[model samples]
Target: MSKKETPLFPLRKGLHTRQAHVDLPPGTFEEEHARQGFYGRTTHLYRLHPVTDWTRIEGPLRPHCYDLNPLKPSAEEAIRLSMFGSTEAGFAPICLLHNSDVALHWVAPDTMDFFYRNADGDDVYYIHAGAGKLETTFGALTYATGDYLVIPRGTTYRFLPESGDQRYLLIESFSEVTIPDRNQLGPNAIFDPAMVDTPELEPYDATPREWAVHIKREHQITKVFYPFNPLDVVGWKGDLTVWRINVKDIRPIVSARYHLPPSAHSTFIANNFVICSFLPRPFEEEEGAMRVPFFHSNIDYDEVLFYSAGHFFSRDGIGAGMMTWHPQGIHHGPHPKAIPLSRTKDRTDEVAVMVDTARPLQATPAAELMENLNYWASWK
Candidate 1:
């Protein structure tokens, strides 16, 4: 696809877009923007009950702090941590980086006896390794390795993992996660919309042994029990539902002359953060073209790269299932060895998902434990 090709852009207003809705759903649509004005795209959603049935049982808001940064190891080198494996059943997802706009988690739940609903925001689950079925009010979404699952806020769902060893990178966005506008990419959208996998509307009516739904609001959890399954929605015709997109199907836009910015690989955009994919692509072939990313500072954004698959030669010791975080105000670039190595490399099979947040992100307690205390000395 040429970079100059364009797609049809039509101004849409009114009853529905792409899909239709029935019963005049009580769920009101809201648009939370990164920029205050009507510039960025909005996510369409519906709530069965606008303002009812939600009881907030609270003791005290969970105390969270990201104000301090532990000094880096002067003589230490860059290190990687494995966020794989499962913890206690109830205490699954290990919190990693978090801020007002987003909360990132690495989870490997052994079993889910109860469903969960996040009233705070929507969730994007990047399956690092796992195969499972996500039972939600909208429908059942079968997920596997490399699937990027987007579940809207207020949606109740439970993960039924089919594999004993499951790992996931879950991004809780306080705002919606939408695809970058095709217009912005011009003709660079080599990945077709058909590659995206939406639910097939297969409603689940099974009667589970334990029918309990857990609602999470304000970082607190409350459980509601039901005699029957809660995924009883027989029909829903709206653009809102669980969505999946595998990295394997995403065709990255690459340039052999001028290295493209991360935005060229933008997969999903949120309020203060944007998710991008770094899949297999040809290296810059131009005689002196910088094949790897140039050294730079995270002046305006906190950058996180979650290594997914393949060999990422740019960074030493970084392997699949590891994450590298360069907080705002820090400067980082490719390893010295990677530069010379790129000279002869014609292509790269690296697969990674990057989260670039506008707001400074703080590492959580769990994430801090897995940190390379001396990672700051790697550049030396």
Candidate 2:
């Protein structure tokens, strides 16, 4: 079918803007392009996620959890040692929701492998730890802990480690992922211009390379098909390609006069939802403000959080590697201890990625086989 003649799926409404106040020094983009050209060498790596016929793949993959104890060589180990080791590799546990549209992936440290693209659905990834290079048809995009990446349906890509040892937390959504709706703000505005911090595309070396494309079919998975790598295209000039922006670049819209609602600093779209973040800044109402996230309900969407770093004062007993899924109907917020422990003024060192979806999410059998069942009753 002709490109323009193809039917288009209606995308939910929302806006994603780069922080206007941030500036990229002259030649930064060019420098990044050059660096990628230099250091990125072509590889013949190929792998695929197991799949079954849609008719046969129906039903829930039982839910489960995993702990990366072996991977943690030391309490202070920042790099994930578990994921890369062959013994515990594919064993990366995941949580599966029966008959829903989402799956939670928890990768232990030091794991490096090909993340197969979904042929039948879109996947959004929320980084939980370490850093790496995502090589895609568009090019290489660098991702660190706390980054969120959306790989639209049918986009082929793979992961490469930026550091020798690192682990990752990945959230895979089978449905279209989007920002929350702006209507919640009552029509004027939310996501203040100052809150978003768009990272400058730091210059990198670039070089030409070739990649192999593998197509999977019922009879047998095909392999070794050569496709001209886009990285060889030498120059790129569009936004429909892979890119990276630091979470810190997303600035919070602070109110000088009144305590702003979480929705005030929120950026909304559809298919899924995301709340930008909070930084160390003065609260609108008091010189020493100890604010906590108010309890709320998402009638239509499931709420999931991937804690990246820092202390989450609002939610008690949560630390890095913890995955919280507050499905519809659950009333969840900080623990009782958190209520009395609120600080008059605080500096937060936490970073995380939060998602709320309008449609119910499903967990794959693979996911069910790897979840931490204990979390199911932790809300109390």
Candidate 3:
């Protein structure tokens, strides 16, 4: 018989309730200090006040917020913003945060004269706004807002945006991005695999000409020219083809008597990171269950949330197309003003994407340029 690596044993020795996230001690807040990003061994500590109730934090670890709306790719690209998708200028995507395992980039919709193939990693493009058509090796996928388009590595593809205002948050994972195991929740709990839409075998018919495919490998682009369009896969069948799923189709898990952890909302997972979606849903209905996110320390992974739409209940001064980077070694939770409203509000209309990475992420220069200063002070 094989032995379990981590035994399931709980030794309770504290002034605690029978269940977590419900019926906390009066006038006390709950702070979960856990291991393995709320997956492994855990201890829920009941505190007198909020863990993030800080007056000041002076260091590099302060949380940050970056705006994608009206923010140009760079200073030089700002001048070319109007000229994007034109014959004169078409810029590249601005990298937001990156580490060894995965990186996030903000795609500024522009004309792509050539196809792109990432030999470095697979790309998961979250359509934040606008509509477009992706011509890939598998087929053509018509993408709109709230769609997640996952293109496998080494697949040649290019964008054909209907308008210039397309906004996308691209997650480049060095490892293969796979559907999270459903465990006991079953396969059809959050979403059904049958609902996942794959591209049709509609190849584009264009004039025969030299086409350039920019292959990115090891942070360098190697242009390869072909006499015809590279997305000419007549008919192919494989599990490793480009696929997409919209946020509307995802059904979040919620309980009236219990508040689920962020891991419960996980949509996709890589080796060292996971992507979750927060959709418009009703708050926990039970009296003792907390409707808002509880205070938790980022003990293992760094948390990055990209706000998409709706009124963000736990956050203030945040709008769509903005992202918050709450680094590790910090305690963060609901904002001061948002807490009072959580009592009255019964539902959350917000749509956001959250990525938790095992290692810390480093922001790119473009992210720094677009950051909304003094984000950490918002907690006060």
Candidate 4:
């Protein structure tokens, strides 16, 4: 519940089902109105048509979809910077969605020569492609695709790509990034925290040379120079180290009788935002149960989804390495074509990362340049 609770009241005013996302009235659609990211009081509005049935959504409030493939560091850019080991113009992480709580960026970095320290917030990087090793204050850890690597704020680190291939969906949270404590589901609901791969202290062998540590605060960069290698820590001990969990290790909670809400898939919680993993899972199998996502306005939070792989059941014309943003005040759910398509399906192979921000996210000019303007028409 939020600071102000909606009095413990339950009332049904319309011709609706007793349970949400279950058997629906004929020729009717469902829209979920939730509070506090679906944990608080909610209402399932049974309607004749989905709220997304709009002819034209003008103004800046319309939904956005960005194809991030073009933004990846190209071979030309990598070859140019391979000698100097500097961040190329196109090699930098492009800020796509951001606000006070969290900022999401797309990065395909080359083997970096400089170490980075985020003085602004904690970083959670979703490995979308390639493999690499990250040397941090704690130690070094090898990273592969589909990994969620959480580096605490102020941790000095540099990502050393194995080759020229490296792409990541990086999220910088303005507050502490912690695991969601599943009160009733127990601590080991989706995954055990102990299962997370942590870095082991290893001597980072490097010749004596001047190293630059780039610190970012308020989105401004400041370089701090050191005579010797900054990652020359011999020993360390702490729980607050760079750790990661891969999507393959995630065991999604599923139900065949009822379709679970997004909150049921909560993976990580932060200040004013939450991160979720939408991995492969079985769909609702009970007859008459809604097989697709119900239409809904987040009401308070802005929604962002990064498609990692597999076919996203609720949408169409979207593939891996793509992103979609649905700000508050709009009702978006499954595309019209998706409802019938899902009825013949039993399980989904989709893998995605979802971020719900309490504050709205502004698309950067870099992200706007990669926008698919016809995304709004896909719902038709």
Please give the lDDT score at residue 232 for candidate 4. 80
Q: Extract clashing residue pairs from model 1.
A: 27-47
The per-model lDDT (C-alpha) reads: 0.68, 0.44, 0.84, 0.84
> Can you write out model 4's per-residue Cα lDDT over 120-163, one digit (the tens) per residue?
89989999998888889888899999999999999998888877
> How close to the true structure is residue 303 of candidate 2, measured as C-alpha lDDT?
63
lDDT of 1 by residue, 88-170 (tens): 25325666788899888776654577788888899899988778888888777788999999999999888888956677888
Candidate 4 residues lying further than 4 Å off, grouped into runs, are 1-8, 73-91
What TM-score number comes out for model 2? Answer: 0.58
The better candidate by lDDT, 1 or 2, is 1
Q: Tens-digit lDDT track for model 2 on 170-238?
A: 444456655545565443343333433222333333333344433322212234433344233445465
How do the predictions measure up, each by TM-score?
0.75, 0.58, 0.92, 0.93
Off by over 4 Å in 1: 1-91, 184-190, 203-205, 208-210
Model 4 clash pairs are none
**Worst window of 10 by summed lDDT in candidate 2:** 29-38
lDDT of 2: 0.44
